[model samples]
Target: MASASTDVDFNKIVKQDQTLCAICHFSWVQKDARCLPCKDKVHIFCSDCLRQLAHNDESHAEGILFCPVCKMAHRWTEEGVASFPRLDLFNSNNDDDDDGNRLRMRSRTFVDAPPNHTRSYVEEIIVSVLRNLHNQEIQMIQKINETAANHMKKVREQRHKLLEEVLMFYDEKESELIDIIREFAAFEKFSKKVGETNKKVTKMKIRLNNKANSCFHRNIEFIKDSSLADFSIGLNKKEEEFKVSKELCRLPTGGRVCNTSFFNDTLYLLTEKFGGSLFFYKLLRYQMKTGIIESLHEWNNSIKIEYKLAVSVNIYLLTVGEIRVQRVTETEDDDGKFSCTFSTFYDIMRRKNDTTSFVHIIGYEKGIVLCCQDLDNIFTFKKIKDPVKQKWKISLNLPLLKIVDMRINSSQLFALFTENLHYIFDLNSGKILNKLKTSTGSPREVLGITKYRFCTKILFQSGCCLIGNDFVRLIDKTEDGVSSWSYKKIFDLYHTIEYGKCSEGIIAFLILDKWINTVYLKYIKC
Candidate 1:
């Protein structure tokens, strides 16, 4: 072979062996090798060189080895061999297979490996979760703080507002007290002056007593011939008249009449026949002086009238727990006979099953106002457009209970009780202005009487004559300063006599005599 050898081309031979190891300069025909991270023709790695490189690395405990040239890591076995195999360039001839192998190589280099749950990846995930939890905690704390701050701000504002209101109230109270103190000082000065005047009067009274004593001794001899007659006379005038039966007027056709009212110089009587119908009654109207009773209207299918109030030509009759407004109209025919017609009934209060509970019914303005027995409450109804339609207007809760009678005077409503206590209320404002205890004790009945107007009064007992005693006193609110002026001696009634409604200058009284069991009307001059 040496004798036949010619000049050999070394460059050609080197070029023919393209698949060789770049790390050891070994041919791929004798040793196993892999492409390095560069993946070029000259940069190929042999297994032995890779083993030696992995053995010399400090990070090999992680089961991975990396190339020194490109710093690309590869998975390595415990024996310091590359676990991922590379395609041999000298064996493959299929283009598809070569493309697939290149694709796999690129995938293995770029794609992530199996998750290392025990190392830095898990620690990083834990750190990120902790960071999110910390942020959420900070956000919650901020929200809570904001809520607390808002609540505190509201509390402070409310506190300041309440403080201002309290201060204003105290200032007003102080001003009132100061005015009261000034008035009290003036009252004390006047009282001292009155005391001095009273002392002088007492001295004069002592001198008068001495002079009277001397005069009595001087007139003792002269009184021997003078006669002293009995001074008690006419003390039982009304008492004597009550024992005798005095006829006021003849009885009407109706069986018996109890409640009566006088309006516009005419007497209105409520008469009901006994044992006929318990709930029906006949309303009779009679002239004051003529005494001729004629049937004005009959209340059929209604509870008997208990209380009534007449004002301004309209008669308010309370029957079956309802107050009705009745108006009488008169018309003259060609025959000169006067025909009267009653107006349609206006329903004010239609309480169910409360037929006999009414204590008083007062017509105020255009509505009906009432107070019941044993009830400390009062209610008012207003007149609507239609007479049949009425609405509740005012409801007042009174401080004093056991109200016996109530009267409306202008803008004030006066309520009287059985214990000599009276209350004054504002009609428009529904506020109780004052409650006063009168000097009179335990009134059986209280009548708010005047010479010009109709007022309220409780029904008096039979044979009761309110004479000489202070029955009622009109209080002048302007000058008297809530004190009553003088008691007005109104009237004295006989036995079984009851006072009825009063208008301007006249009042009516009904007398039920037991002699005939008949009802008579007595026209009283006011």
Candidate 2:
């Protein structure tokens, strides 16, 4: 009875054994099929379909071929790789029973090639690469030679014109000398002909003296006013000597100054008092020339003045609770007062708790931007025409983080984070375009940044100055878009520095000597 049951099960299994491809879901025979190296060992598809799938699944970067079923990578099996059409297999007048054995024997013979053959193949590839490199070098040398020839031609033309001018001036002077010699000879003849006291002799003597005098004046003028003296060649040299003028302003109470900015070319310092009830915070205005420190205005309110910004003809004084705009006028009165009038204050994000928060302000295009130091919140304010309501058009928040310093140009902003990371972001979209390391070697000891010329230090213009206790370097971008620092010992090292933009290539920075309790106004020629 058990033998009968086993026979029935074997019959059932053989009846259900029909081969179907996993990929196409069509019936396939065992002759034209391949399988992945998996535990199932079931026929998947034909070798052509498997090769196509492998080509599609190959990852160029990773340099690996993946299995379609398991989604895992593996080396090619011998039988599966030999089934490819391009590979030439051994042909013999044999039936299908001996085909697999013959193919295995042929593959083994191909793999056992001579060692010298592999070595020669690799050497040929290396020689081809070297030849290509030599051709490129030849082309580069030709380009350089052509460029140098053009520059040399221009230099030769300049030299020819200068030498010609020099030659012409000397030639005319030689003619003038000949005329003077003739005048002297004629004067001697006249003296001999007329004897000492003759009337004609006196007139001739006067004429000779006048002619000689005119010739001397003309020769001197030509030599002195020549264009040869006007030629100046500029060399890339460091300017070490600076014309410095310094003044000192002594503060009565050593209040912690928050920030500094320039408006209408005048210096303004924002100071905050810690505990005094007389004046909580004050804005001190100093004349750049006279070094006069006068309190422009004082506020005793609970909300603190964060920072001041001068953006596009408008002076914005931002505080924690409200934003104030002072219309910076072009005219100033004789009493040393700006013709600026304060507009009605606009509201900011109010303080949640008693915890202190610092707001950094930078003047951007057509508006002013304010950022909080603690939170990643940014706001843009544009002064509108209607003063009564919504005078400052505030934009949506910008997600900036841990901003330590910010420098603004017309288009972009360079935000320096607390971690010494520098980010360049566009103004309109608020998207970061690039990030770079500000310093490479030491712990960051950067004090602040001062805007110079048109752009800041990260840009490729007349670079700005970066002030720090360890070093004060003028950083500029190179042609390959890398920032390089030109170390400058232009100013004395101090604890804190606050600068205001003066004329082109000039800046007025205040150095606060913490030990002496004195502030020095330093005018720098950058």
Q: What is the C-alpha lDDT of each candidate?
A: 0.43, 0.46
Which ranges in model 1 have alpha carbons more than 4 Å from their true place? 1-247, 253-255, 276-280, 289-291, 299-311, 322-359, 364-393, 398-403, 408-421, 425-433, 437-526
What lDDT tens digits, residue by residue, belong to model 1 across residues 106-142? 1111112235534477766665675466456556666
- Listed in order, each prediction's TM-score against the native is 0.34, 0.40
Residue-level error in angstroms, candidate 1, position 401: 5.3
> lDDT score, residue 64, model 2?
46
In candidate 2, position 506 carries an lDDT of: 34
Q: Which stretches of candidate 2 lie over 4 Å from their true place?
A: 1-241, 249-254, 274-279, 301-312, 321-342, 345-358, 372-401, 410-418, 428-431, 437-458, 469-471, 477-483, 486-492, 504-508, 513-526
RMSD of each: 34.7, 30.2
Please name the candidate that would achieve the greatest TM-score relative to the true structure. 2
Clashes of 2: 0
lDDT measured at residue 114 in model 2 versus the true structure, 0 to 100: 39
